[model samples]
Target: MGSDGSSSGVVREPLDYVGVTNRTSSGFSLIWDSPEEKYKNFVVTSKDVGKDEALKPKSTNKDSEDDSEKEFDNKEEEAKYEQTNKSESENPRSKDENRVPESVSTPDPQNKSGTGSKPVTGSITSFKKVLPGSSRFFQFEDLPPQTEYTVTLLGKGPGLLSRLHKLVISTGPEPPKDLVFSEVTENSLTVSWTKPKSPISGFKVTYTSIKDGEPVSVSIDRGDSTLGLSQLSPGSSYEVSVVSILGLDESDPITDFFMTLPDPPTDLRAVNVTDTKALLLWRPALAAVDKYAIVYGSGTDSELRVTVSANAAEQQLSGLQGSTTYTVTISSQLGSNESSEASTSFTTTSGSGGDGDGFGDLQSKDVTPRTARLSWKPPTKPAGSYRLTYQTEGQEVKEVVVDGSVTELNLSRLHPSSRYTVQLQAESGGRNTAPLSTHFTTDCSQELLNGILKSGEVDIFPQGRSGPPVMVYCDMETDGGGWTVFQRRKDGSVDFFRGWKEYIKGFGSLSGEFWLGLDNLYNLTSMTKMTLRVDLRDQDEATFAKYSTFELVKRNYKLIVGGYSGTA
Candidate 1:
């Protein structure tokens, strides 16, 4: 009621009884009966205290002795004191029923009342002086929660001795702050918060799914500020609340909302594939989505991407390659969140004409050291002709043209054990189809001889040969094995006489009576020791001439032969 203490000569008497009227997390209120004896004013003061200090026995020092004498000095105190006249009543009340209420106190530095003047330090102290006619109720506000406070009442006047009454009480706990959600996934999320600056026994966490409005609650230790929740539905919204607890009291709830990640599209597949386009289909995601992202790529190529609205169940991809395998992935998106991807693969059908037609199933067969047979299915539409081009690693491309009716062609003069890429295109009315490609490696003659068992016309690589393999007639069933025939004359269908140039350069076929080139013979014989055999064949009888250790000099027609043993 009053801020300053009363003037000197007024008589003062202690209040009769002081009791708590109301209390909250932040503050409390107190009420006291007016004293019977005359008094100018009553001073109320309070300071925060630790639990241990609040429970300690009251000190018997001079100030405390005086406080005891004035404790509950009025009529209500007299009745309660007489009822329970036990020695333990001398102690301050510690239970909740008798806990002290808080009050704002104003300092009265000018008061010259009769009392000791020792200063109170390191504590929150205030004085509220009530006049004779003012209300006896007082409230203290803006106090820390879950904290103990010591409050004292003193009747002060000029000639009257000052009396002190003390009480201890605690405020309710404060709520936690700064609630946050982290590490959120499709079915789980982590919640954390800042602890309130007050003593608390623990925390109570409650969450309810917005979809079903079913609430779940859990108790958490005071030391932990984070909790992980799982076993929830994907793409769901949840309301979460946190409350701090102290003994039987709890703070107001702090609440927020959170969401789980959306589900991804499922059962992705490709259909209606064409040489230049493909259609992608999938089952819709269970959760609502904003869009869908599709990504695709072929072997070692940069990936391509496209997007479709969430309502769409299929997406068409264009500008794809024919007869090529590709991998594709699809994912659902909601707001800024994207779900995990669902993936599939497919190959486009061959084109009908221009750029991606014909030759989709190009293949190679009968591959030898120096020759291979190339074949393919005819184009969907007829064409004037087909052009074929081929090349080995680090070599110039070679090309050949064939009639539209030809579906297969024989390739010749290829190197042994070499990799080659062949591309074929169908041409019609000056326009050409997309080139279809295939790869093959030529076999060495030695491999064919060893793997085939029987040999006729074959290709061979002489010792130290590099440019290309040689075409030859191998006599595998002779007296011994593995013979290269440079000359054979079993029929008169071929001419024997020929110019020097004709002899120098090969003018023969391995399957007929012909002569192998002198240049080739010289190269083969010069590389290593060789043996030659000449067979004379008539109607039913045949005679043979044989020579071991034979050689042919280069650039000249010189011949060397020795060790003949066959009858001629």
Candidate 2:
């Protein structure tokens, strides 16, 4: 409606609902229809037309003036009514503003839907939302570096209302260039990245020991650019991904993996031992290790077993028997880092048994005494007569020749009841008798009588002496076999010598001393002056080579003469 109460040919058409336009005037007034009606007015100065007049606030003009003003207003009112009647009251300034400027080029404001304007140039009302109350905006801060994440903005109301200004601002720092893990310590790791180009709201890092799985999150405060991951397992590896947030936008995720420092070998010890069991022990491998191997055996034969971290130095082994020799070698990874190894071994106890000549021969029987009547046979050997060589226990061997073919031989005149050991010999030609031996105690008793037979006729002899008495018998049986009996007297008794004369080869002389030969027979009367040369061959054989001169004292009637035996 015009001021004159007529339709203006400048038709008051409705503005495009998406844009604000007014055909009435450059300035307008909003009237409140409340009980206290009031008006809030706004004015558009020449500054609204691209002139800088903002310094002065302009107001609408309203005045009752002179006759010229009244006439001008009347005519202006007529013109307005004529335009309304013609239905041509369009906003003239709107067309000029819509025309593209010749100096500046721009894309069509129409959107994919051919909407009124593109979000890029859209007014404050064009803000759109993706999620409700789930978004935040970043002002001046740069996006986190080497990080990945997602962001969402929320709209105030439901429906197709473009309520979110979600500028999916790639504004997120360029997914932190060169996201890296460094300065790793025993229990912590430092992650750093390049500076971002745009502002960021927050940052998050996902990390875990496992691969291809959901990781744990470490959030960064608004102003922090670096992350220090703590409480990390020592000697462990972790895969990390970063998520950066900028306003309501997120950057592409970046992933990286790193391992913690390695630990030293543990659980070192010596295990079981036998005569040959290998020793063993083990420890878990650290993250810095490439593999593991063990060298174990008797101090010899060292074996190397290759193993990975998962199968680290376990208690299993090859070529290692229970209670056998072993050497352990635990090795770590190689690089700027140095590796290490250790070794040990032990032996098992053996069963109780052994082999050898453990004992000497032992005599099981006691020998007879007084008369060394010993019955001994070779305990083990080629049999022959026993020489019955004996010596007192702590005395030099006193060789005695006992004559007899029987295993039992009587040795008369042995010290009464003295102990003696007889070594039986199966002596052949010249060999010594290595005889098994026997020992015995002796029972020696005084002889009943003693007698001596000299080279002379007996003048008197004791006869019919019936009493307990001791006697001595001496005879040169080789020359003359004679018997003389006498009663032993404690007081130099006078006794008679009665000769049996039958053994005396009358009128003959004899030579040499009557002694036992090496044959052990009381046969050969060895001449003291003669050389009885005997040649000893191998232990088994011997030969008598020479028999030299010899002499013997003999009695011939009333004269004592020397008997000579020529050497042959």
Index of the highest-lDDT prediction = 1
**Model 1: pairs clashing at backbone N, Cα or C within 3 Å:** 8-158, 16-74, 105-126, 105-127, 105-128, 106-127, 355-434
- The per-model lDDT (C-alpha) reads 0.66, 0.35
Q: Which residue runs does candidate 1 get wrong by more than 4 Å? A: 1-45, 50-124, 127-142, 151-167, 174-178, 194-200, 210-212, 251-254, 299-301, 350-568
Compute the lDDT of residue 255 as modeled in candidate 2.
83
Model 2 bad stretches (over 4 Å):
1-170, 183-188, 197-203, 208-215, 220-226, 232-238, 243-252, 258-266, 273-277, 283-291, 295-568
Give TM per candidate: 0.41, 0.26
Highest-scoring model, TM-score:
1
Provide the clashing-pair count of each candidate structure. Answer: 7, 54
Error of 1 at 109 (Å): 27
> How big is the RMSD of model 1?
31.5
- Let me know the TM-score candidate 1 reaches against the reference structure: 0.41
Encode model 1's per-residue lDDT on 143-217: one tens digit a residue: 666666666665534344343566666666898999999999877899999998877899999998786677899
User: Where does candidate 2 have its weakest 10-residue lDDT segment?
Assistant: 38-47
Candidate 1 whole-model C-alpha lDDT, 0 to 1 = 0.66
